[model samples]
Target: MLDCFHDECGVAAVYGNPEAANHVYLALYAQQHRGQESAGIASCFPGDDFIIRKGQGLVSEIFDQSQLALLKGTIAVGHNRYSTSGKAILENAQPFVIQYRYGRLALAHNGNLVNSDELRAMLEHRGAIFRTTNDSEVLLHLIAHCNEPDFISVLRSVMSQVRGAFSIVLSDGERVYGLRDALGIRPLVLGELEEGFVMASETCALDLIGARFIREIAPGELLIIDGKGYESVQLLPKLPRTAHCIFEHIYFARPDSYLFGHWVHDVRKEMGRQLARESHIEADVVIPVPDSGIIATLGYSQESGIPFELGLIRNHYVGRTFIEPKQSIRHFGVKIKLNPVKSILDGKRVVVIDDSIVRGTTSRKIIKMIRDAGASEVHLRIASPPTICPCFYGVDTPTRSELIAHNHTVEQICTYVTADSLAYLSHEGMFNAAGGGGETFCSACFDGKYPVEFSGMDT
Candidate 1:
């Protein structure tokens, strides 16, 4: 099957305790699936100085035992990133720490800034030299240039100008700061530990590090945790509505995470049930495209009264071929990643349930594999609607021209995937699967109705 763009960006931070850096590292490890392009950790030493180590690689590859041992501090922030706003490079890896008038700040940010290009231009005209191409650098520059006597006031001034989804964590030698956008387009939650307060993009990270779950950080909230104890300030009142990303329930988040007051795993399975009801496939066996689709496939199997089988086995040890560093090697990466369970599929009618189809290359390959495994008929059912448009907030989908759904009809997509039948969960179905009622969500990736405006300066 063809590959999809890797999930991008995860942030974790801790305030209090000398082992904060090590804790943040482990927290980021739990969120490694969210981003695999690069990893980094920055900590504020108790004496008000900082130590940072970041590089272009997975969390495990970049931070060895020795590296973690060296970073001793009381406050720290960590990040794992996939290049969404800029080309992949070590310089773009975060936590983006810089020396400023108010002292020094280390920042690890999740989500894209829709107005960053314009803000960056304004900063450049005023003589701000940028160190990285990613929009996160704009945050540090803004804070550095703010003339406000207090750092928090400067942070408020800077955050006010930033538009779009962002869940950011900053460390300024003593306290840890967590800020979320007014629209709340991305997920950010708070946790408590014996040593301090913890913040992460997902609850899975907190559970990984033995942190107790705390309430979610509200939209437009600025949280500060330090020796004086934890406190929150409403930088802006909660807007009349929230724009939480719809895809987080579909694919981005770890199943263990609790988001939007529901378990991610349960939500995905419900989406599959809804898709099954909408599609109503008749097949000898239902199969999932391993990993992401397992829960959905199970739900589909239950709803359709069809037996579920593991007809496709994934090689857990196959490091993502996307990181092979050579285009030629990457082209054949999927062959090593998945193997068809021939015995189970031989002479059977198969219905494959997947999360969604992006470019369609992967689904086509999967269908061909099932056919080759002797399946008499193959049907494809997607849990979410066709991703016809790219996501500007955080997801890394293709441009319109590259999206198979953007240019083709459902029947055409079926022919392309060589399936006996093809069906997708309707937009309304997805909304219902996520949760019922008239609650609003950001469906920009599915319907292209962005909740925020884009400046269109970055790829």
Candidate 2:
């Protein structure tokens, strides 16, 4: 659903490609689905200073041929952002560039810092100036003020102090660095480019740039690329348990990407299969909500022995519908993005498959649209379990009071959406579909068992 929770950000970097900025731009474009609020690229040459260009817009809107031509370097880092911590402003865009004792550094971060307020206050008291309210700026101050003698030591010291999910990419005019938090609540992967090494939030970005897939950057791992190629360092002792965010498999990640060693598309399809087994209903046709639901809908149709049809068509050209006329129109917001296929739904009992439902408003509008198109019955099947709590790590989620699932039972939700029936995949079913036991992934949004304690922070 377009009204669903938003992902944090996407990070992309190249260590040795001469046209590093161009490659990073392509990678960010491929991972644009992760975040759309802002886009940026920071490049560094061997002897030259960091070249940075960032703005509050899409990659295509921010960078043109001339802009790319100006960013000359063999090392680059880029970010696509949807704010989870900082305000939506130009200064909050990444990769944030700074000059410290070590040298010029550019950093792009994905995920929220639970202790950012505490860290920021400490830094401020010590006379550290901040240019942006972004939690990412705290890292720069931490690294700059550390008493450690070397870059690697300073990074390790800084990582040990911060808490919460962080998958970061940093460059110091020549070398590129990648790091993941101890719990690995966010995703980051390493890839091999023809000219050098690449790192991104997802493998889809690497595929777009024709890079070979390398393994995921392990939890608490630090990867550095310089003249000596890539060097991996274990920054912290492996935690007893890791909190791999389960939502990545259910939503956030691109279907083409591999996350947690499983192809995202395969996991989603399995979730649909599991949903079919858990809740089987006889229907004339199975239809997906389009885009996000396409793979899962296919699995639902296959497992249930029902024919799958394109019952909804989405307008690819429409950017997010952020505005509506003061004079209300019937389902005006949804109508701008999606239209139902009358011939396919006419007089048929349709099973509608969707990834998840945040609030009942969007689902209700979609169901009503199907009904108006002449559908006899509308049965809603969600591939993932209901999201009952807000996520603090990275995802921008509605408060618990705003969540329909948190406030209403499944039967009540069915009534609220005016669907003939509604069913969501069970927590166990989701775990199985994701190819990991319950212990391996974080299901805090579904079960309210946060792996990391935010304490006084407002999530």
Best by lDDT: 2
lDDT of 2 by residue, 294-358 (tens): 99998888899999998999999987546888999998989988999999999999999999999
Give TM per candidate.
0.95, 0.98
Q: Candidate 2 — worst ten consecutive residues by lDDT sum?
A: 450-459
Clash count of each predicted structure: 1, 0
The lDDT values for all models are: 0.85, 0.92
Cα lDDT tens digits for candidate 1, 113-199? 888899999999999998789999998888888888787788889999888789999888878889899978888899998988899
After TM-score superposition, the amount by which residue 200's alpha carbon in candidate 2 deviates from its true location, in angstroms, is 0.7
Candidate 2 ranges with C-alpha deviation above 4 Å: 321-327, 457-459
Cα error, residue 77 of model 2, in Å, equals 0.8
